[model samples]
Target chain A: MTYCVGIRTNEATIMISDSRTSAGVDNISSYSKMWRYGIPGERQFVICSAGNLATTQAVIAAIERDIKNTAETSLLTVADMHQAAEYIGKVSVAVQEKAGGGAVFEATFLLAGEILGSLSGLYMIYAQGNYIASSRQVPYLQIGEIKYGKPILDRVIQESTTIDRAIVCGLISMDATLKSNLTVGPPIELYILQHGSLTLGRYRSFGEDDEYMRDLRKLWNKAMESAVDAMPRLTLS
Target chain B: MTYCVGIRTNEATIMISDSRTSAGVDNISSYSKMWRYGIPGERQFVICSAGNLATTQAVIAAIERDIKNTAETSLLTVADMHQAAEYIGKVSVAVQEKAGGGAVFEATFLLAGEILGSLSGLYMIYAQGNYIASSRQVPYLQIGEIKYGKPILDRVIQESTTIDRAIVCGLISMDATLKSNLTVGPPIELYILQHGSLTLGRYRSFGEDDEYMRDLRKLWNKAMESAVDAMPRLTLS
Candidate 1:
């Protein structure tokens, strides 16, 4: 299981993903799920994957190969973010089909990035090769074990949210997921594309014991406890 | 789909459940999931249902029939809380089997109650006739549409938690689930059994527009928003 979320705010786009991947309880391992691709200052795409490790790796390799070969319809050559997403979807489908039939070969992805003059975009590509872009009413997309982390995003994220707030909200959402589920654990990887900056604006990874991670957890916990205290009591009449 | 949770604290035990039932998105209706049974002042149990609605109704009817017929293993005749749970599990399995074989006939339950002299118990009965009791380390059991409501329960409820806190936490948890999922909705039913009373301490049902429910949602959302503001900034260096 995995948890990756992409938040598109008016000022920036952010994507965050957990690193833990487990085939089973005993087969747990840490693998970064975020793959960065682009030519600096020209275009940038951050692809976050959740599903069979082999399938995601194959899909990423295929994308890298396309870029390297200067394929007619690669991420670098796509006209806009939609086409880039569609190309990834095509690569994903081809890879899964070649791997043969089974849910085991299934994978999903969140693609977030920008091209020089086009509007920044965030999209979720499904295992079936279809994709959907985020809308102004709900400016986020998630893939993987998403439920535990979703309430915060539902409450706090929207088109008008600031980039910094979006980044923090994404982190808190991931923290809620990691706390409630063992399948998703640290280190967490995040990519930020600040408005107007063509290339990735900031990227950071935090391990389980990282100071910032610790502080975030502590602060969030305290705030939740206080929130609970502040809630209206269940009065029975 | 349904969402129900049982929390056992030192002073009392509480069960909360959403009322939404749906065969599909278009077929949605309200039906209480919490069923209370016991001889007041002697014994009491609250069973919360999830999964096939037909199967749950059948199971409840069977329990009622057994009690009315003075069956040797009925809830009124069970020797202890564990036996009562086992009785419910047996009844559930029997009900599912009688409805013929299909996933649609399977049901799960959270049973919370206490006998005259036994310690209060919280049990989760699986569809397979097996049940597990909640432990002091984790004194809550949830069934159906559980993930969206889990983080708050994980963060707040414990054996040492006050009953009021547990009740509020359970309500907030339900609210979170209802907010993130369309399949789980109001009116929410809650039952409370305070320690040694051997009778229900309180029972309340809140509709979507219920004033208390409205206030709870308003306060919780405000708290969460403030929490996001109090979180540490994601300082990039």
Candidate 2:
């Protein structure tokens, strides 16, 4: 299981992913789920993936191989962010064709970034190679173990949301997913793309023992207790 | 869809369930998911249901109808909490047999109570009639839309946890579920059982204006934001 979120804000785009992967409780490993493409300052794109690690890595590797061997169909050579997303979908389809083999494998990606003077859009691409762009009402998309972390995003995220708020929302959302799911663990990857800048900036990870996460856990617990205690009691007949 | 949770502590047991049931997002209705039985002083039991509401209600109705006709197979006549769970499982099977019609209708029940001088216990009964008792390490069980609210329970709940703490944990867990899932909605039912009390105590429902829940939502959002702000930045390479 994995948890990855990408948000498009008025000022920037934020992408976050967890590094933990597990086949079962006993077998756990860490793997980076975020990928970067394009030349810095010219055109920048970021893709965060979730679902089957093998499938996602294959998709990314296929896209990278295309970029290395052929420029016509590569993300870096795409005309705009839309074309970049199309390039990703095409690569995903190619990977799926080779690896699917009549069996079902679920892999999805959240693509967000700018292409210099062009658009910065966020698209959620499915295993079928189809994608949907985020809209004003739904400015963010989450993949893998998404239910646990969806409430915060549903309540707070919007098109006009600030980069700082979006980052906080993304983190809290991941925090909820991590607490509930054993498969999603620490060392979270976060990336911020300032609107129109095209280049990725402010990429980081929050690991276990990070003071902010500790405090968030403590405070969330305490606040929950206080909230339940303060709710009015319902009397039965 | 529904959300129900049961927690056992050294001093008491807590059970909570939501009233909303939905076949899909557009089709939703209110249905009670809690059932109680047994004599108040000698022995008492509470059962919370989550899954197909029709199946659960049929199971509860079957139990009540049997108790009305004969004490020999009644919940009130069960010798111990384990026996009571078996009785509930049997009733669930009967319901399934009557309405199942070769199709799978999944329903789960969380049974907890004490009988006179006997010990108190908590058990989770599945659709197939098999059950598992709660242990010290895992002191609670939740069914239906459980992921959103499971984080708080995973972090704060324990077998030796206080009744107040457990109650709060249950409420927060329910809150998270409610926030994330429209299928699990308002009018939450909560029940408490003190160890050796042999009776269910403190049953209540929280509506939209429920103050404590409102405060919890507010405080939790604030706490999450504060926690995110306090997170340390990763030094770049």
Candidate 3:
């Protein structure tokens, strides 16, 4: 299991992913779920994956191999974000089929970034290989253990939200998921791509003992406590 | 679909259930999901149900019939909270079996209350006619569209939490579910049973336009905004 989110605001695109992956309760390992692709200043893509680690790795490997070989439909060859999504979806489906096609080998992804002149966008690719873009109304897409982290996104994310706020919201969302679910753990990866930059804007990783992560958690916990305390008290008879 | 949660605190038991029932997006109606039974002052039970509406209705009807008929193992005759849970589970499985025992006709329940000379407890009864009690460490059980509403419970609920705080948390939890999922909606039914009272302490139903519900939502939204704003900001390059 994993948790990842991709948010496209007016100013930039933000992608966050937790590294923890669990085959079962006892067999847990850390694997980076976010992959960056494309040539700097030409195109940029961040793919955050969930579901079977094997399938995601295979699909990602296929993407890298295609890019290395300049395959006919590789990320470097795709004309737009839509084509990029389609190419990734095709690779994902082919990988799953090669793995014998079942629930165990399924994977999902959130693809976010710009294709040269195209506007920055976010899309969630399904296990079936179909995908849907995040709209101006929602402005975010999440994969894996999504529900625990969704309410905050639904409450705060909008097209007009600032890049810094979106980053904070994404981190808090990931933190909420990590708190409620054991399957999603630390060593979190976050990437930012300023709109039209055609380059990775900022990248940071937070390990379990990282100072910034600790401070963020403390601040968020305090905020939640204050929020809970401020709500109207129930008057029981 | 529905959202129901039962929380047992040191001072009381709190059960909250949304009243929305929908077979499809086009077909929606409201029905009370919380049912109170038992002899007040001697024994009391509150059953908050989710899943197949028909199966829940039948199970509730059967429980009422058994009590009215003075059957051997009715709620009135159950010796303890565990027996009450077993009785309800048995009834639920029987109802599902009568409906042909498939996912379509399955229902789950949260049974919370006290029997004379016993401590208050909360149990989550599954469709398979088995149940598990809420633990001191968790102090809560949720059924149906649970994840969206769970982080708050996981954060604040404790064995020593006061009844009023528990009720407020339960309402906020239900409100979160409502905000995130269309399948679960208002009006909301909340039931409170003070520990050792052996009676329903208070009951309130908030309709779609209820003043208190509106105020709570407003307050919570404001709290969330402030929380989001107060979180440490990211310094992106």
Candidate 4:
């Protein structure tokens, strides 16, 4: 299980992914789920994956292989953000082809970034080589163990949101998920892409001792308790 | 999709269920997922259903039919909470039998209550007629679209928790679910059973305009935003 979120805001785009991957309780391990592509000042894109570890890793590797081979449809060579999303979906489908089918090779990606002179977009790519771009009304997309952390995003995330606030919301959402689900753990990778910059900025990983996350967990618990205490009780006759 | 939760505290047991039932997004209707059985003061149990509405309602109807026939193993005639859980499970299995086995008939129940002189307990009954009682480590159980609302319960609930706090937590949990999911909607039905008392102490349903729930939504959002704002920033360079 995993939890990854990407938000396209008015100012910038924010992406976060938890590192924990677990096939079962005893088989839990940490693996990086965030990938970045393109030259620094030319064209930048971030890909965050969730689902089967082998499948997602294979999908990423296939994309990287395409880039190295100078394929016409590679993440780095794509003309725009939409093309980049298509590249991701194509790669995911290719990976699924290699895995002998039993259960569906479940994998999804949250792709966000910009091309130098083209549009910036946020897309959720499915395993079947299809994608949906985020809209003004739905400014964010999440994949993997999403429900545990979704309320925060549903209430606060908006098209007009700032990048910093979006990042904070993303982190808090992951924190809430981690608290409820042991499958989504720490060492979270986050990527920030400023609108129109064509460059990824502020890429970082939050580990167990990360002060912000510690404060997030503590303060969220306190606030929940306070909110519950403040609610007026119902008196039934 | 549905959402129902049952919490057993030292003071009382809390059960809440949403009134929304849907075959798909288009075919949705209001149906109470909660049902009460047993004599008022002798042995009382509250059951909240989640999953395939038709199957769950069928299970409930079967139980009611058994009670009318003076079956010794019926919920109304069960000796204790464990027996009551078994009775529900048996009914669930009977419902599955009537489905003729295509896809497994999906339904689950959160059974919580007490018998006079016997212990209070909360059990989760599966569609297969197997049940597991909640313990100290896991003092509450949720069925249906549980993930969206689970964080609050994970962070706050305990076996020795007060009924007042449990009730508040239960509502907040349901509120979180309602915010994130369209399938689980108001009005919300809540039941409170005091420990050692075989009768229900409180039962209420909050409609959309219910003043307390409205205020709860406002304050909860405010507190959550404030908590997010108060989290320390990541200062890594």
Which predicted model would earn the best TM-score? Answer: 1
Task: Return the clash pairs for model 4, or none.
Answer: none
User: Chain B TM-score of model 2, please?
Assistant: 0.93
Q: Give the DockQ of candidate 3.
A: 0.64
Clashes of each: 0, 2, 0, 0
Worst 10 residues of 4 chain A by lDDT: A97-106
* Candidate 4 lDDT tens digits, A138-202: 89999998988888888778898766667888987898888888899889998888887765567
| Residue-level lDDT tens digits of model 2 in A1-237 | 899998887888889999998888888999999987768788878899887777888888888887889866788678887888777877777777777543356788999877777778889998777889999888888888898888667666778876776777788788878887788888888888887665557777778787766776676566545544554443443
Question: Compared with the true structure, what per-residue lDDT tens digits does model 2 show for residues B55-90?
Answer: 887888788887888857788678888888888888
Indicate the residue-level lDDT of B41 in model 2: 81
TM-score per candidate: 0.98, 0.88, 0.95, 0.92
Q: Chain B alone, model 3: TM-score?
A: 0.97
- What range of 10 consecutive residues in model 2 chain A has the weakest lDDT sum? A228-237
Candidate 1 regions exceeding 4 Å error are none
Clashing pairs in 3: none
Ordered by TM-score, highest first, the candidates read 1, 3, 4, 2
Best by DockQ: 1
Give the C-alpha lDDT of model 2.
0.79
Quote model 1's TM-score.
0.98
lDDT of 3: 0.89
Output the worst ten-in-a-row residue range by lDDT, candidate 1 chain A. Answer: A228-237
